[model samples]
Target: MAGVRQNTSIPIPAIIRYDETDKNIIGHEFSLLEKAPGKSIDQIYHTLSVEVRTKMVHQMTDYLIELHAHPWDGYVGGLTPTNGEVTPGPPIDENFGQLPDLEKYWAGSESLESLNPIPSQGFAGFVAFTVGCLDHYIYLCILLAWFHLLRPLPSPECKGRRHERP
Candidate 1:
């Protein structure tokens, strides 16, 4: 968010304070940001005239152009604040937090950080890293599917059978 604010004219709310660790009083990482000065887009979008909507779209396009014009230094990963400067970190996945028992599905002995470290070889390395992660994920999925398929079917009469399809 801070990087976006620094790089673009996008109207991001000012982050008053933030904590990346769960040791704070809140017991979880959180950011406190000043409220951005605008009504919800959903509330006003339907009420907007075609001309107004078109203008809004154009403005959004300009913002996107500004963002793209100022690309990060070719590291394909999330940004973290280090000593008040934004630094590259591991690629963030929505499933990292949301998926239950995610570690069980990981395919290799390598940790996520080891598997997808910040590529020292810049954009080309980032591309290779992305492809490698995708391949690993695909392999894990296929392995899990095969494991399920190869498991013995439960006998209907045997309630204690452990291999029943859920």
Candidate 2:
């Protein structure tokens, strides 16, 4: 993982953990991996310029292609060489056929109601106040413009004119 860089063939959020009970034994639910260093591709993207960013993107695509071509039989369940759950050998979709329960998922939709029953009158009042403030601002601007126009100044060159001295 020392050589791994931004947008390299590596999984995001390197760790995912879950809490469990005695029935679960708590020991088997981990995917310990060869740790990669530095920040994610997102961090790199923010710092890179437009031209460099395009090249970085192309490099990432190439990395993906290489990873896909070479099957990963090297590391099994754990990072260490000896003690790791032997992976089920080669590719097979893990969660392919199992259909997800839609009802349990949709149950969270009820929370959207809290965002409703909004204060319409308060919003209308805010809009009206804003309009009033805008009108006052416009009036002030017009008054200022008129005063500026009316105020007189002597000609820059004082050309072709005589001023009376008191």
Candidate 3:
């Protein structure tokens, strides 16, 4: 947020205080920001005239253009606060937290470094990593399909009999 505020003309609430560690009184990381002025776009969008909406859209596009024009380190990851500086960090996968049981399927789920391919390896390396991940998922899908297809089904007429795939 600080980096974005520093680099772009976008309006953002100023951070009053923030804690990234669980040592705080709340026992969870949190940030307090100044209340931004103005009604949310969703709240007043319907009430806005077409001309107003078009002007708002143009303003938003200008902000986006400013953001895109801002310089960034060439890396495929999210910005994380490291030693009081915002730096490129491993991309967070929200699914890992949402589905705890699926964590086992992903190797090195506990280690962020292991999850992210080194940025120094360049675009080719990233492409290879992506292809490898796709291949792994495709293999899992095929294995699951085969498991369902090969499983024995109970016979309708006989209570103790099972029907096998011929």
Candidate 4:
């Protein structure tokens, strides 16, 4: 978040505070962000003129280019609190599982045995890990859908019935 704010021209809400752990002051862990200007594109995109839509698309593409152009030190996981350093860890949500480690995903055994590990290799390992993670996610989704299908339905009385508001 900090890197995106500092390095890119993308307009994102300024993170006021981030709490990874909760002491329960607010009863939930949360991040406080400065109020962002304007509404969601969903609310107004259909109303935009062709010129405005073209400009929006161009701006979005420019932002993507600017973001991807940032030099990476070869680490492939998400940014860490260690000042943008990347580590093999759970991506976004750990509730699923962690990303594959470098040793596990490395293509060459010689590279794994090397005393001096190159950072560039990290990107390749990360890519392999991401692919495997995606497969795992798909399997999990299918399993979840099957479970939901097999689960007992709610009692008829528990189901909400809509009434006409007169």
How far off is model 3, as Cα RMSD?
A: 9.3
Candidate 1 regions with alpha-carbon error over 4 angstroms? 97-166
Question: In model 4, which regions exceed 4 Å deviation?
Answer: 83-90, 94-126, 142-166
lDDT of 3 by residue, 44-86 (tens): 9989999999999899899988876766644433566778776
Give the TM-scores of the predictions, in the order they appear.
Answer: 0.60, 0.28, 0.55, 0.58
lDDT of each: 0.64, 0.40, 0.60, 0.56
Residue lDDT tens for model 1, 1-166: 8878876789888889987556678765578999878798999999999999999999999988887677676555566677988776555444432112234445455344443333423334556767856865675565457667667666789778665357
Model 2 residue 30 CA deviation (Å) reads 2.6
Please list all clashing residue pairs in model 3, or write none if there are none: none
Q: Model 2, range 62-82, lDDT digits (tens) per residue?
A: 877765454444322111112
Tell me the tens digit of each residue's lDDT in model 4 across 1-166: 6657766778878778766543547644567999888888999999999999999999989998987676655445444455544233333434422222223434343232131222323344556656755765675566456455555666788679653322
- Using TM-score, give the best candidate's number: 1
